[model samples]
Target: MNWPQSFIKPKYLSLTYLLSLFLTLFFLSCEINYDGDERLLVTGRILNENNLPIPNQDVEFWIYKGSGAGGDDDLISLTATDNNGQFLMLIPSPNNEDGFELKISDPDTIYQHKILHRILDKNFTNYEYNIGDIVLYQHHVITNAYITFNKTTVNTSLMDVKFKGDADYLVWINEPETYYGDYEPTLAHDYYKNVPLNSTLTITYTIRDNSTETLSTHEATVTINNENLEYIINY
Candidate 1:
């Protein structure tokens, strides 16, 4: 039985190898389950058309439970942007078949609301997702018009102005709502208002002469486009 030491199986070495294999299997099982209380962090920024940060803006996050349009939405969190237009929040990781959405609104009525959607699978582990900058556009058009009278009189004044446009167009006259004083007759008046972008706008101007009791009106039609923010009208 004492042939040589090399022919003998070391019991200590065999036990050490079995213990290492058991530890490896245990760690692998823990990773599969991922049974931890860790959360996912998300951060982003909001900006306007001028590439400026929009501070004190509200942002919302929602999670989709089911599939397709019939899915139920679960509100996760709501936060506001800081002075620098930065936002950060933490939410639980969605299930393997779930999705998420983010929404931001323009409360000042200067820009349009933004909504983004994403589907996060199981591959997305505990990590911080930075969405960078989200830019919004101006919802309405700021149109300005300048007026000139064909014949200037001592009692000439701007009476009023009216605007008409296509079915989807909305117009509001902002300046010269009332008649100007005869002593303060001016050659120009600015008509500034917000209207829908990319539409046809028809402007009508009214001029009055107190002494002669004469009322004059003029009409002009112009197509409002993104490039034409401000417009000029002659009467």
Candidate 2:
């Protein structure tokens, strides 16, 4: 004997199926919602105290424990600040409570001084951060070196040069070889090392500009192995 279809199916089974389908579609069409609260989105522009946008800055947000989600470990990572110092990021789920960190640095010398700090905010877009201008301090040389050589040996020593500026810098030294006892250009845009006795050697050092897209140049000359060589730089 076969069971009747109506007897096998619950009276409200069809209605239940339709209701579930409707709910799923509705939720999918709408924005995120949980625990009776709607999702929140925030964004904003980053600017320095000088009113210029701090390009290439890093911006990140984290969770706040007291606000509900526990702490930083539960935080989400966001994108870096754009060339215009603008950024966008999603808020956390559940409590949606969070904080953020802003970091700005020099592209050239990552080791140079930097600005970093944490900001406590529930809404990032609603807030405007006025980070001050990132001023890079100049480097100063504490000591200078001048190397000379004689037959059978090389001379190493320091020279006292008065630099009339407040700066921190790196010094590079080079020894060029020449055919005569006087420093001269033996190669175009190139210099050689090591020379025989009676050949002149030109030793020079120059300071370099420690910045992005720029370089500092200086040169000096000295006699070595009876040759004088010309170099475009000395430190």
Candidate 3:
């Protein structure tokens, strides 16, 4: 049984050609991406100061290009938290020199806005990033006031308090009308009352010594809105 060399060579060459074609197609399939850039997954939860989940809040992702003089932010994705205060977002792969910023805000005006600057570094390609829990503080119209006295103070009792604003505007204080200090001035007093949003609040207080002598008089003004406010008075 003798086979011709010419026939064997043709069959071997044909098999080699078919094998090369199959390998080329397999590699091409592996490298092709039909959906464009690779996607990066991000997950997080939103909570309030009370440690309760905040649902239905808007979460935003911003991508920036360049730096300093020519940098600009581009809104990439917008998503909302679920009932459990959880959110997931898919971000496309960024360039080697791009930056990322994340922001979340309550739509019901109950919590203050929160912003996380530069959460993602540059050249963060297709990868998952977990931000865990982000807590927002409650918005308050009133500010808490703490008053302290220096070692040279004689009297430590508030005698008179005055509010200068519209006559129709009502000023309220959660603490006692008059605060009397013993050895140390009360530093944890909540005297400032909440005012209507977007209003100007001015408070004046007179403190006297134990012998009925006026120790000091002080005044402070703040523009009240949806942000947290705290005032400290050192006599």
Candidate 4:
């Protein structure tokens, strides 16, 4: 006669034991964050006068000085506006017993705007303000617009270039309107994928708007093997 299966229990509660271990760990972790109030954080948002979100605008806060330390030029914390012109910034309490101030800056401007100035109370946190729609004025002058290459060479090869400008424009080969073709969005962010490298290479630029033409063209000639390669017409 065979002993019944239940007559002898398994030496180990393998499955049951493993499950209990896992559950214990999970419950322990839950106890840590169970309060849900530990994350008590100070938060705020920024909006335009029209109650619109201003994206990419920088906001800063600084410590205040009552002794006419107005020229204390250092930023404690900075937060940028989001696409909706809204910002959620976090500010830590000051280490010393000093006053505090707040300032906002427009990314497009040469210098940022000083939005607010005041002394901070001991109980300072969770600040909010509606800066309104900030007018982004043009700061880049087109007169100095042009392409720059690493080095003009005699070898017939292509080289990548870093193009920096205010807008996504085109680089013409010869005159503003003349070129191999219009190459753009040109390296996306301040970079060109492939640029031609020749002994005598000349390049110009054209604005996005075809109606307005460039005032002048900028050209760079490559010195290959200590020889000059001229491509211009002879009189």
TM, every model: 0.43, 0.28, 0.44, 0.31
lDDT at 12, model 2: 57
Q: Is candidate 2 or candidate 3 better by TM-score?
A: 3
User: Between candidates 1 and 3, which one is better according to TM-score?
Assistant: 3
Q: In model 4, which regions exceed 4 Å deviation? A: 1-43, 66-74, 110-114, 122-235
Against the true structure, candidate 1 has what lDDT? 0.61
RMSD of 1: 23.7
> Candidate 3 — which residues are off by over 4 angstroms?
1-35, 67-69, 122-126, 141-235
Error of 3 at 145 (Å): 9.9
Candidate 2, 1-235: lDDT as tens digits = 8999888886657888879988877544342223334334546565543356656655454433332232223335456667876766655443433334433344544222232323544323433334333332311211222233222212222222222221122211111122222322221222333332332333433222333323333334433333333333322
Tens digits of per-residue lDDT for model 4, 157-192:
222222322122232212322223343333221222
Best of the two (1, 4) by lDDT: 1
Model 3 alpha-carbon miss at residue 161, Å: 36
Number of the top candidate by TM-score? 3
Residue 221 CA displacement from its true place in model 4, Å? 66
Candidate 2 regions off by >4 Å? 1-38, 66-72, 94-235
lDDT of 1 at 193: 44
Candidates' C-alpha lDDT = 0.61, 0.38, 0.61, 0.39
